[model samples]
Target: MVLVDAAFIIELLLKYSFPVLRDENDRIFNKPLMLQDVWSHLQLLENQLSFFILEDLFVPEKIPVSSYGEDAEKLSIISLSLELFTSLMHIEGIEENLKTITSTFC
Candidate 1:
C-alpha cells in the first residue's frame, strides 16, 4: 500500500469531496495528479509537520548527547528509545494532523 502523508490525504479528500471548477468553454476542468501529486501539493504541509515535530518537539538540544557517551551499549539503548519515541509521536500526530489539514484544504 502507498504510504500517504497528511497533505496527500488532504488533497485527495478535497478532489474527491469538492466540486470541480468549469472552464469558459463549459467543459469540466480538473488537473491530473500522478502518484506524487499528493506529495507535490502537500510539500509545504509536510515540511511544516516535520519542522514542528523535529525542530519543535524533539529538539536536539533537549536530547543530551554528551550524557549518553562513553558506554557504546548505553548510548545505543538511549538512542533507540529516543528514536522509538519520535516515531510513535509522529504516527500519533498523523491522524490528528491529517484531520486538521483536510479541514483547512477543504
Candidate 2:
C-alpha cells in the first residue's frame, strides 16, 4: 500500500493529473483519513476531482475514513489537505513535521 499526502491528492485533482492513480504496481492508500473534505472540495471545484475519482479510484473498501481532533470527527481529503498546507505554511517546525509524516507514509 502506498500512502499519499492529502495535499498531493488535491493537487492531482485540481491539475487533473493522476500519474500516481495510474500506478498499477501498488495499491493507493490516502492516509490521515479525509474523504468527506476531499469530496466537499471537489464539489466546490466544479466536480473536476470528483469526476476523476469516480472514473479512476472508486473502491469503497480502500477508501478508509479515520477519526480526528477532539470530537473525533471524520476528516475529508480536501480539509485535511488544506489544513496540512496551511499549517505547514505557518508553523516554524513544519519541515520536521513534514519529514516525519512523509517518511512514515510516502
Best by lDDT: 2
Q: Write the per-residue lDDT of candidate 1 for residues 1-85, one digit (tens) a residue.
A: 1223433333333333223412344222244434244344444543434423322223333333424445222222223333333
TM-score of each: 0.18, 0.24
Model 2 agreement with the true structure over 64-87: per-residue lDDT tens digits: 222213322313343334454454
The C-alpha stretches of model 1 lying farther than 4 A from their native spots are: 1-12, 20-29, 40-46, 50-106
In model 2, the worst 10-residue window by lDDT is 65-74
lDDT (Cα, 0-100) at 42 in candidate 2: 46
Clashing pairs in 1: none
**Best candidate per TM-score, number?**
2
TM accuracy, model 2: 0.24
7: Cα error in model 2, Å: 11
